[model samples]
Target: MPVSYIQGFDPQTLREIVDVRHCRERLDELGDQRSLPALLERVWLLKVTGDLDAALAVSEQSVRVARMGGPRKDLLRARVLHATVLQFRGAYAAAVQELTTCGEEAEGQGWAALAAFAYQHRGKVFYDAGDFVNARADFKRALFLRQEAGAPEPELQSTLAAIDAAERRRADVSVAG
Candidate 1:
């Protein structure tokens, strides 16, 4: 895993988007010799900074590494992260496709938490695409699964709020129509 703190950076700065292209290029040059954790970290940082293109590149590379190393957990994570990057880039359908695949894989592996995360991200993509009904359902499923998986309280609360907001928006649309 990437260190939560980097030198010369405060806690908040740890997530600051820097030049991830350089890091990605270096990792690519190193090929299979590169560290998985480091690559994941760079991918995370790039995604956080809204550099979707670079993040996608790193995420795809991470998938390859995970497949080679036979780390199913890491592979699922990379797929979900890549989907999230696509969502942020406004590629809702593509993001949904990616998340759907991740969800299937997670379910197959009996990883409820990962599956829940995939559903949650996919729900957000639906919301972005204005598919409020599907979004609400997916978010609710995510909330249920996340709760059963004993995920953090903050995440649960946030998902709940999102569901509520989406529902309210949908209701308003119904009334207006």
Candidate 2:
């Protein structure tokens, strides 16, 4: 499910369908105390609501569940989403770590689109931190992967422009020095 859709789903509907309490009850009923998807959903909700600490707590839980389940795909998604949350909170170094792990996992899983998205997000984090060199490198990688995956052009174009601008600024600074 798309993150937007998941986030936009009515809380009432969630209560009826996949409430955390209900999920916990179901887990108890099933004698399996791990509800990875539900936990991830909660974390995403917390993130969208700008509750970083709550989001981080749930994200950590989701990572543990994904690890125990040995589902690389879910693990990659969780890590990438967690990294995005961290980036939004201005935790750049931690975001970089999560994104690097996500990239490695995506590469291992042969998920090109996911890898590209991770790179794009990591680049944005670097860009926000004023680390234009690393930002340009990451954005370049994202552009390559996105192009290879036949992604929409407009998105890549904007990022490419940003990278170009950053590089030009760096060049200007070097010349001025």
Per-residue CA lDDT of model 1 for 1-177, tens digit only, reads 233322222221112334446545644554544577767776766676566787788888877887788578888887787777787788888999989999888878878888988998888788878788988898898898898899888678767876886787789789999
Q: Which ten residues in a row have the lowest lDDT in candidate 1?
A: 6-15
For every model shown, the clashing-pair count is: 0, 0
C-alpha lDDT values of all predictions:
0.74, 0.70
Instruction: Identify the leading candidate in terms of TM-score.
Output: 1
lDDT of 2 by residue, 12-44 (tens): 111112344443344345342348877776665
Which residue pairs overlap in candidate 1's backbone? none
TM-score of each: 0.76, 0.65
Question: How many times do residue backbones clash in model 1?
Answer: 0
